[model samples]
Target chain A: MIPALGLIVGIALGIFLDPSVPVWLQPYLPIAVIAALDAVFGGIRAVLDGIFNDKVFVISFLSNVVVAALIVFLGDQLGVGSQLSTGVVVVLGIRIFSNVASIRRHLFHA
Target chain B: MSSTTPPPPPTDPTRQESGWSRLLEAAKPRANRKTAVATALALALGFAVATQVQATGKQGLESLRTTDLVRILDDQTSRNERLDLETRRLQATRDELVNGSSKDEAAVKAATERLNQLRILAGTVKATGPGITMTITGQPGQVTYPTLLDLVQELRDAGAEAIQIGTARVVAQSYIAEHDGALYVDNTKLTLPYTIKAVGDGDTLQAAMNFPGGIVETIRQQGAEATVTKAPSVLVDALQQPPTDRYARPVPSASPSAP
Candidate 1:
């Protein structure tokens, strides 16, 4: 509940402030978003399983975003940025799908 | 009464908790500080995501070099200025056409006058009016191409609207060149005693030629006889072939006033 409220406030602040992002970070934003989504879904799954840990959830979210961005950065240095980005997205996407499936089962039992 | 229960399984009191159960215990939310930290992190992540999405929605402008972005801005500004000027010109033309009958009549009159002026400059029609005539009788070598050219220049400077030398109409693109001890005006040969008729103010045309140290004095100095006459009506009956421009055709305007 707190995280959800935080997210809402953060989005409002972003809209009202309208701060511009730096150019160098442009390539990493999409990857980081995907990774954050994966972490959020995982956190929801943990909550359904009665094992939700705030520290673990936040750490996982930060690490996921950072690691994803780092992989893309390394790939860019190696001239394979797009390929590495696709690989990271595929892995994180699979995890998000599984977590969402579990959440759905917990909520709807279908 | 009864048989004794089966022997109880032996228990080890010193056995430690398994790693899996310990990990599950740690994964559970515990303190207020941990929850606060998580919320703060989530807020920051959300803000970053929202801002980045908004920035990306600008069609990837952030990826372009600063110089390239500035060049695109400058190009758009210049193009906008040119389009604005074109729009103003077209709007003025539209207003002139749409205002009222009196304005329309004035516009038509102005257009007709302009057309007549252009026709005169093109020399496609014969011109007759009050002006001056100059007749030059000289030795074959006395009145060269340069002398005739100078006379034409002087008449033009004195506001002679239309001019004819011998049998050739002096339009904007007329050329006079000397060849084989004679002169050719627009490729037509001229005989001696050339007669030049010009349509303008007769007094001004006469004075322009008779000005001290002007064409007349210059011609007399060269042993030629020059006579200037202010006639009530001078006729230039020569016609010019309509010029054919291979390029530079007019573009039709987009406004409704276009004809």
Candidate 2:
């Protein structure tokens, strides 16, 4: 509940304040968002399973975002930024889908 | 068996109380702190996502490299220059058309004046104007072709618009040649005494001839009697054959569509 409240507050603040992103971070923002989404889905699934660990959730969230951005940065250095971004998105998307499916099953018992 | 089961009843309440305490212990402040940390990360993630989305929505400039940005600026500058040049060319053409329409009365007057001048130059219209006439009487061989040519050149230089030597009209393409010790102007044989009539400002024409060491002096040096007289009105009756152009043709304008 606190995390949900914090997310709502953060989004509201972002909308009202309208802070600009730096140029260097532009390439990483989309990947970070996707990674964050995957972590949120996994956290929800863990909660439904009665195995939610706040430390693990926070660690996974940070790591997912950092690793995704790092892969893209490396890909850029190797002149394959777009291909690696696609690869990262595909993997994270699959994880999000599976977690969401499990959450749904746990909530609906179907 | 019933007696043995009844003996354990005394410990059931204590055991149940211990289970409840353990459950309470698990739901303690430690769990709350973890939740707080997770919430803080979530907030940061949310803020980053929202702000990034807004920035992306604003424009794609941030995603481009400095080189790409500079290239785009250069492309736009060149395009602007090309557009400006096109605008200036179009403005000149538009001004020509607009002025043509707005000054229709003045343009018509100028056109009429130009047509009269062209007709006079062509010698296709009868011209009557104040001018000078010169009669040359000399020995047959004394009045050479060069001396007559020099006299015509002097009259033209003094603004003689229309000229006639004997019966031939002196248009721009009139030819004069010497054949068999005699002068011929446009196939007309001239007599020894030649009369030259020129339509222009009489005073200027006479002054041009009388200028010291001028055409009169040059002709007199050849032992020819050259006399000049200014007349209020001199008539030129010769007409020119219309010229034909074989190679040049007019280009058709873009026509308006029929409504």
Candidate 3:
């Protein structure tokens, strides 16, 4: 419940402050967000599976965001930025779908 | 969410205790602090996600200052207008240059043709064609300058293209002079036998010479012999080096009545 309230407040603050992303950082944000969501859903799933660990969750979340941004940055330098970003999105998207499915089963048993 | 603890006896959030108290009770001090840290991390993650969503939600330029955006738009519009004007000016210049070149080409061709014809007419080039040659022989004083000039006039009227008499090319400026019962064509004195080479139509020139009241009858009356022969070809090899005009230049523009 605290986490949910925190998320809501964060969204409200975003709407109020209206912060803009820098041009240099814009390319990797969506990708980093997807990676973060993947980590969050993984943490939730781990909780449901009786394996929740705060250290693992924090480490995984950091690694996921960093690795996703690094892959896109490297791809940009190598002149394959868009294609590599698409690849990252596809993998992370599949993970999110499965985790959300698991979350649904845990929450509603449907 | 289920806890990684000893199974509670099928407990749910009831009127027994608050969620925070229950959560703290369920964990040791170390686990409790970890849970609090997790909640704070979740808050940060949520903030990051919200910012990302806002940033990507619409046009990337939405974050720019109004003044900066207006400046950029004004700059782009003026640049586009300038480019359009430049394109039109270049196209017009190209079209004018193309038309000028085409006109210059045709003018050059016509002028060259006219120059060659003028060269021939001015006796700068050799003249050749089928025509008649007239030879006049008379004892000392019979063949006079007036008779010779009249003969030239008659041949000119009959459309003689070129005429040469006794090493003298008869052009527009040529004059026949007689001094002391002697004839001179221009500065060259004529000998007894005067042969005139004329390039023209053979039959027409020959008939013109023999007509009544013509130079042939006048020469016969003058006790001189005028013999006309139609040749397959008559060549006037004399060329005139016309002096350049000192005080005359070509007019730049044609008069209104000029064809």
Report the number of the highest-lDDT candidate: 1
| Clashing residue pairs found in predicted model 3 | none
Worst 10 residues of 3 chain B by lDDT: B1-10
lDDT of 3: 0.78
Per model, the share of native interface contacts recovered reads 0.36, 0.50, 0.31
Q: Write the per-residue lDDT of candidate 2 for residues B11-43, one digit (tens) a residue.
A: 344433243343334334354677788778879
Which of 1 and 2 is ahead in lDDT?
1
Instruction: Between candidates 1 and 2, name the one with more favorable TM-score.
Output: 2
Q: What is the lDDT of residue B66 in candidate 3?
A: 43
Give stretches of model 1 more than 4 Å off. B1-31, B64-231, B234-259
Model 2 DockQ class: acceptable
Full-model lDDT for every candidate: 0.81, 0.80, 0.78
Q: All candidates: CA RMSD in angstroms? A: 19.3, 14.9, 15.9
Give the distance in Å from residue B163's predicted Cα in candidate 3 to where it truly belongs: 1.7
By summed lDDT, the worst window of 10 consecutive residues in model 2 chain B runs over B1-10
- What lDDT does candidate 1 reach at residue B54? 80
DockQ of 2: 0.27
lDDT tens digits, residue span B1-259, model 1: 0011121232433212232343345345555776677668778878987887788777466665444578899999999999999999999988776787677789899999999898888998889899998999988888888989999999999999999999999999999999998988998899988999999999998999999999999999999999999999999888899789999798888997676
